[model samples]
Target chain A: MAEVTFDKVRKAFGSAVAVRELDLAIRSGEFVSLLGPSGCGKTTTLRMLAGLETPTSGAISIDGTVVNELAPAKRDIAMVFQSYALYPHMSVAQNIAYPLKKRGVSRADRDVRVAAVAATLQLGALLDRKPRQLSGGQQQRVALGRALVRDPRVFLLDEPLSNLDAKLRAHMRAELIELHRRIGKTMVYVTHDQLEAMTMSDRIAVMHDGVLQQFGTPKEVYETPANLFVASFIGSPGMNLVKGELRAAGSGLAFVRGDLSLPVANGGTAGAAVTLGVRPEDITLGAGPFACTIRVVEPTGHETIVMAEAAGETLVARAAPDSQLVPGQVVPFAVRAQRLHAFDADGRRLPLVFAQSNGA
Target chain B: MRNRSLTSRILLNVLAWSIVFVIAFPLVWMILTSVKPQFELFRIPPTILPQEVTFEHYHRVLVETPFLKYFRNSVILAVGTTVLVIVIATLGAHSLVRFSYPGRERLAQLVLFTYLLPSVVLIIPLYLLMVWLGIANTLFSLMLAYTTFALPFALWLLRSFMQGIPQDLEAAALVDGASRMEAFVDVILPQAVPGIISTALFTFILAWNEYLYALVLVNTDEARPLTTGVMNMLITAFNIEWSLLMAASVMMSLPVIIVFALLQKHLTRGFGAGGVKG
Candidate 1:
């Protein structure tokens, strides 16, 4: 296992910058995820770490050794592509043993190593089958087995679970977590799915438009998003953000936008434009300072997502699954003040002072 | 309903068999003509089957003429052309599909454009070039001339086949500690087997039947392939020996027919797999 670092790395493809001024230091044996939507440079960053792509500027080092000029084979890194990319012509056993053969491993050692990997992935029965003969989940295991047989220093996965069905994705997600725990290798997983990052990563590097938005533990990023992008992008329904101006209210400040005003204990200049963010689960329905009419209600078995209009702005809140909420019904709701987040006009997070819960 | 369906199935089979017979009539006639006695050719209305079968034509062509020498030359030329063209085209196609050099796309288009050019138009310039190189009458020269056309055709066909292979397979191999060349051998080549076999068959057929270049470039009986050699038999003979020519024609087609039979599975699979997904 090795610690990987990208020091001010930037990649440009003929003037269009894919990644810019990216700096990340992943510790040895840590499972970190680069989370972003499409075209956010997450995949490019992972490719750079794998030596598949060269950073236009800056250095990428593995275990204190810079690998900018090294070939992918010499980098000692293994990658699992999103497509699984099992060789169609080779049987499962041959696919798993390909890397060893290339490295000139003896036939006996290759067989033993391939058998061990196959047993780990429960692929012993399918060893003689070709890649096209196997199901998608089986192909995924073969791809993983190929990567694992090398025991490379770092494992780079590019949206490896995106192709599987929902139940299989969840199952494989748990399996990957277990695999990581057992192997204790430095794994850099690239994914647009925030749930995968939140569930599996020891630290999540949230990115947007070639910029690193936030890099922290899952809870830290969820509860204390570094900016408006992270605040809005990290949740299921995402955090509800409303544009308002901060005004003096008694000893503290009250965020005001037309008919909707809520007291906020935040350090911001009065009359300054700011955006207030509240998590869907933190907004309790039926009682508080704000009154709103319901717009849409989506019950997703476990919880009900309530969309309501407050002062011409739509706010989403999570409520009980069996809640009797309908459109056009006026309901009073409270924003958990201590759990609230305020961002400046530039979308950077502003310091919020914790106060008593504004729950009714 | 069952009787009507049976009638329609019979009609379809008859139609299909008629088409097959029309296609195969010439080949059947050639074999029969080769076995018929020489005098049967001019018997009023021509006999479809000879009154007596004779091996006299085959024996004369095999023993009395230089048929064996020309057969050996054709074999050398076709096999050499196929091997040379396939080796060069495989590497060229892989580079064109996988690498991104400047003008790579334009080069692939140029290769197709060369294949589209008629070989008749190229014969004169190729003849002069062969003479200048001082290797005019050798089988090696014919192999070189054949490559001029076969290389581009093979490259164009194999390029499409290589393109069907997913790029991720090579990327996976590279990340699994295989170098680029190693990945080409282990991953790309095996996937392109059917395609390569079909391309080799095409190149061989092209070199085997080529006549104009052989007629123009080589004058000696020493270097003459069957196409020119057999034509010489008719031109130099006192009588027009149709039976001997027919027998030699049948002999000339046997190798190609045998090769096609051996690789028929890969050939059809190549047509489907190369044109579609890998």
Candidate 2:
């Protein structure tokens, strides 16, 4: 296993920048996830690291050696593609043995390694089957097996579970986490699924518009977001933003927009425009301090997402699924003052006053 | 509803069979006439099946008219042309499909234009060029002309097939330790078998039965193909030898028929749904 470092990497196709001046360091044995929506350059970042794509300008080093000139195979990296790119004509055994064969490992040794990896993946009987003969979940295992036999320094997965159905994706997510723990090699996974990043990563790098917005552990990013984009992208019912001008109200301050005025428990610099964000779970749905009309109610078994019009802006509330709530019902809610997040007009998160907030 | 529909379906089936027979009568009649005894042929109301079948026409055609030489010549030219065209077109189409070269799209359009160009417009100049090279009546000249005419169509057809293999498959192979060329050969080529086979059949049939190029390029039976050879069987005093002519016609149609039959599934899928883009 080896550490990977990207020093000021910049990539552009013609005039459009794919990845804009970025630097990151993934320590040995650490699992880092690059998470972003499509066209956000997460995939490009992974590909550049894998040598599938070259950066327009940057120095990438693995194991303390600058490897910008090294090919993927030469760098000793294995990749699992989202499509599970198994050779349609080759059986599972042959697919897993390909890298070993290319490295000139003895055929007997190659067979032994392939069989062991197959057993680890519960693919003994499947070794003789072609990709087309296997179901989607089985094909996923074969793709993983193909990467495992190499025992490379780093493993790269580009949305590997994206093709699997929902239940399978969740199952594979846990399996991947366990596999990483067992092997404990450096792994760099790319995905747009926040849930996956939150569930499996040691560190998550959030990207937007070819820019790295934030890089931190899941809890750090979820609670102590650096900007508006990270705060909104990492949550399911995303943080609610109440837009208004900040002003002194009672002992603290308040945000006043249209007919709605939301009081902030902590006051900031006199009067300046700012946005306050509170996660849905931090909003209490009872007659306490605030009121809003419920526009929609979406029950998801464990939690219910309540869409409400508050302070003339749309907001989402995550509440208990069993809560008696319905559309078109107006209810009162209060923001857990400690959980409130304040963003300046520029969308940069304001420094925390509630240092002891449960999040950190 | 079920009982009435069943009887009507049976009646429709009979009608459909009759229509098929009517459409196929000419080919059936032609085959029978080729083997019929001269006495039974062209009777007051022609014979439905010959009373006595004979191999006399087949024997005469094979022995008297340099037929064996013509058959051998046709086979060599057709097979050679098909192989050469497929190889050139496959490599050409693959390069066009996979890489990003300057003017790549324009070059592809040019190839398509060349494929669609009318051979009739180029024949006069092509013939003069052939004679100037002193290869006017050689099988080599005929093969060159046919391959040149067929290359563009074959290239486009294979390009469609090449495009169907996911670009990721190629990238996956490259990452897995294959060079660009190895990736094409090992990963892309296997998936393209169906398209390649169908296109090969099309090119071979076109070359096998082509007459215009043979008529102009060949002056002797030594270099002639089956189409020109059969046409040569007609003469004023010999009364065209209809039986022998028909026998040669059946033989000429056999290869094309077998080729189409073998590739019917691929051809249907290629044209109907699983085309290049799809």
Candidate 3:
């Protein structure tokens, strides 16, 4: 096992900076995911670690050795590509044993190691099959086996489950977690899927537009996001953000938009603009002062996604499926005041002290 | 959504057969003429089937003349040119497709631009260079000239084919402890087999059928390829051995047909997507 550190790494292509000021330290045996949308440079960062792309500036180290100048073959790392990238010309056994052969392992040793890996992956019967002959999930297992058989210093996976079906993706996610637990090797995964990042990674580095927005444990990011982007990006239906101005009220301050006004506890300057954010699960369904006309209600068996419009901004809130909420109906709602988040005009989360409004 | 009627199907079959026949008729006529008696070729209406089929022309091509020697020379030049073109083109195209350094785009463009220049324009300077090297009228000159002409197109085709291969495969290989050159030889080259085969075929045919370079570069039968050899036969045989000339032409095309037949299986192997779902 090895710890990976990126010391202010930067990558630029022409004038476009694909990744910049990327400083991250992954502890040994920790599962970390570089999570973001497309073109967010997560893959570029992973490639830099893989030694496929050299950083424009700064250094990367593995186990205290600066590997910035090392070739990928010398880095003692293994990566599983998003496309599964198994050598099409070789059988499954050969694909898995490729790294051992490259290291000049004996033929008998290579075959034994390959067979053991295949057994672990339940690919014994498929050792002789070509990659194209296997199913998508099977091919993915073979790719995983190829990476696992090497037992490299670090394991890197680039959206390895993105190509699989949803059912298989869930299955592989569990397998990957168990595999990580069994091997306890440092793994750096890259993906745009937040669910995968949230459920699998010990820490998730949320990125946007090639910049890291937040880096923390999944619980830390979900409970307390760093910025507006992180707040809205982390949760499932996303956090509902309503932009308004904080104005002086009778006893305290209130967030006031065109027609909607809610008393908020804040010490900011009067007339200062602020965004009020709350997750959908934190919003309650009935018997509260605030009201909105439900525009759409989707019942997905267990829960209902209730999208409502308030002061010309759409807010999605989740309720129980049996709540009997319907479109075009007004429903009284209340956000959990303690769980609410506030942001300034610059989209940075504001640490505000809430002053009770006496239910007014 | 219904299928075509019986008559329309019959009509389409007839049309397809007619097109195939139109394309094949010339080669069919050449093969028929190669086995005919010498005088039967100029007979009025030129008999479709020879009254007496004879192996005399084949015998003459194989025994009476320097045909076999010229055939060997042609084989050497064509195979040499093909080998040279594929090796240089594959490496050059791989570099062009995968790497970026100074003048990369310009070099790629130059390769394609070189292909656009007609071989006639290059022949004079090439001939002078060959003479300066004191290799004029040699098979090496012909082989070198063919390689030069074929390299650009071969490079262009292989570059496009290489570009279609995902960069991930090589990256995966590198991560698996294979060096860059090893990845190329073990991973990229095998995936490019079909393109390489087609490139070999194209270069071989171009070299085998080339007339201008062979005629301009070589004079003696020792260096002359099949294309120039056939012309030499027409000029020197005095008797105008039409049947023997036709047999020589037929023999020159046989190798190409056999090469295609042998490599066609790989051409249809579907590439298997190289482990990429898309």
Candidate 4:
């Protein structure tokens, strides 16, 4: 296993930059995900690490050795593409054994190693089947098996689970976590799915528009998003953000916008413009200090997502699945005080101190 | 309604069969004419079927004329041209599809442009070049001449075929410790096998059926292929032997038929497996 680092790496395709000023260090044997939307340089970053695309500037090092000029074969890294990229012409066994053959492994050793990998991946029965003859999940395993046969220093996966169906993606996600645990290799997984990053990564590096927005553990990013982008991008149903200004309330501060006022536990410059952020689950829909008219109610089995309008701003709150909240019904709501987030006008998170007594 | 549908189905089948018969009639006539006796070809109005089947025309063509020698020369020219052209085109197509260089797209378009030029326009210069090189009147000269046209056609065809192969497969191979060339041999070449087979078949047929260059370039029996050699039999003879010429034409088509039979499976598989998804 090796620690991988991207030091001020920037990639440009002629004039347009794909990744800019990327500085990330992944610990050895850690499963870290590069999470972002499409065209956000996540795949480009992964390709750069795999030596598939050369970074336009800066250095990428593996195990303290810079690999900017090294060929992909010499980098000792294995990658699983989003399409799986199993060799269509080769049988499963031949596909898995290819890297070993290139490494000059003898036939006997290659067979033994391939058999061991096949058994690990439960692909023994599919050894003779071609890639097209296999199912999507099976092809995915063969792609993984091909990568695993080399046992390289690091594994780079570019949205490897995106092609699978939802159920299979979830199953494979758990399997990948177990595989990472067993192999203990430095794995750099690139994905746009925030849930995948939150579930599988030891640390998540959230990126947007070619810039690294936040890099922290899953809970750290979820509970304490570094900026407005991370705060809104990291959650299901997304965090509700209302534009307003901080004003002096009784003792502390209150965020005020027209007819709505909510006492906040944080101190900011009085009369300064700020956006109040709250998670859907942290908003109590039945009773609170603020009143809002329900605009839409989305029932998701265990929880119902309710979209409401308050003081001309839309807010989404999660309610019990059995709740009978309907559109256009005015309801009193309360936001968990300590669970609130405050961002400045520039979309940067402002530090907020929440005392224990401020809890709802 | 069921009866009406059945009537339309029958009419469709009749139309389809008529089209097939129209396309196949010449080939069927050739085979039948090759087997019929010379007397039966012009008897009265002409018989739809031969009353007496004889191998006399086949026997005379094989023994009396230099048909076997011409067949051997055709085989050499076709196989040699195919091997040479496919080797160059496969690599050229791969480079065009995968690599980036200055004027690469323009170069691909230029290759197709070369193929668009009629061979009749090129034969004179080609013949002069072959004579200057001292290889004229030889099978090697014809092979070189065939490649001028065949290479461009093969390269253009194989480029699109190679483009259908996903780039991720090569990247996956490279990341799996295979060098660029090694990955190409192991991954790209195997995926391109169907395309290569089809291109080879096309190149072989073009070389085998070429007459203008063969007629102008080579006059010796040692180097003349079946196309020009068969045509020479028609003009040089005292009397036109229709059955004999038909027999030679039948024999000339056998190799292509056999090659198509052998590679038919791969050709069909190529269409179905054009791209790798998921």
Give me the candidate number with maximum TM-score. Answer: 1
Candidate 2 regions exceeding 4 Å error are A13-16, A59-61, A64-75, A248-268, A284-339, A352-360, B1-23, B37-48, B131-136, B220-222, B233-239, B273-276
For each candidate, report its DockQ versus the true two-chain complex.
Answer: 0.73, 0.45, 0.80, 0.72
Evaluated on CA atoms against the true complex, candidate 4 attains a DockQ of 0.72
Best by lDDT: 1
Across residues B62-124, which tens digit of lDDT does each residue of candidate 1 receive?
999999999999999999999999999999999999888789999999888988888889988
A best-first ranking of the candidates according to their lDDT comes to 1, 4, 3, 2
> For residues B1-278, could you state the per-residue lDDT of candidate 4 as single tens digits?
99999999999999999999999999999999999998799888888888889999999999999999999999999999999999999899999998888899999899889878988998889889999999999999999989988998788778878888889999988888888888889899988998888888889889989998999989899999999998888556478778999999999999999998999898776544544331
- Local distance difference test values of all predictions, in order: 0.91, 0.85, 0.89, 0.90
Q: On TM-score, who's better, 1 or 4?
A: 1
Q: Which tens-of-lDDT digit does each residue in A1-360 have in candidate 1? A: 799999999999878999999999999999999999999999999989887788999999999999999988899888999999898888999989988988889999999999999999999999999998988899999999998998889999999999899999999999999999999999999999999999999999999999999999999999999999999899998999989898887788778887877766557789899998889999989988778999999999999999999889989999998999999999998877788898999999999663544532
Candidate 4 TM-score, C-alpha based? 0.90
TM-score against truth, every candidate: 0.94, 0.86, 0.91, 0.90
Where does candidate 2 chain B have its weakest 10-residue lDDT segment? Answer: B269-278
Stretches of candidate 4 exceeding 4 Å from the true structure: A248-254, A262-267, A285-288, A299-301, A320-331, A354-360, B1-54, B237-243, B268-278
Tell me the lDDT of model 3 at A336.
74
In terms of DockQ, the best-performing candidate is 3
Candidate 3 lDDT over A1-360, as tens digits, reads 799999999999989999989999999999999998899999999999999999999999999999999999999998999999999999999999999999999999999999999999999999999999999999999999999998799999999999999999999999999999999999999999999999999999999988999999999999889899999888899999989888887878887777666776756777888998889998787767677899998999999999998779888888888988778898877777778788899999888655433353
Write the number of the candidate with greater DockQ, choosing between 1 and 3.
3
Least well predicted 10-residue stretch by lDDT in candidate 3 chain B: B269-278
Using DockQ, rank the candidates from best to worst: 3, 1, 4, 2
> What is the Cα-based TM-score of model 2?
0.86
User: Candidate 1 - CAPRI tier?
Assistant: medium
DockQ of structure 2: 0.45
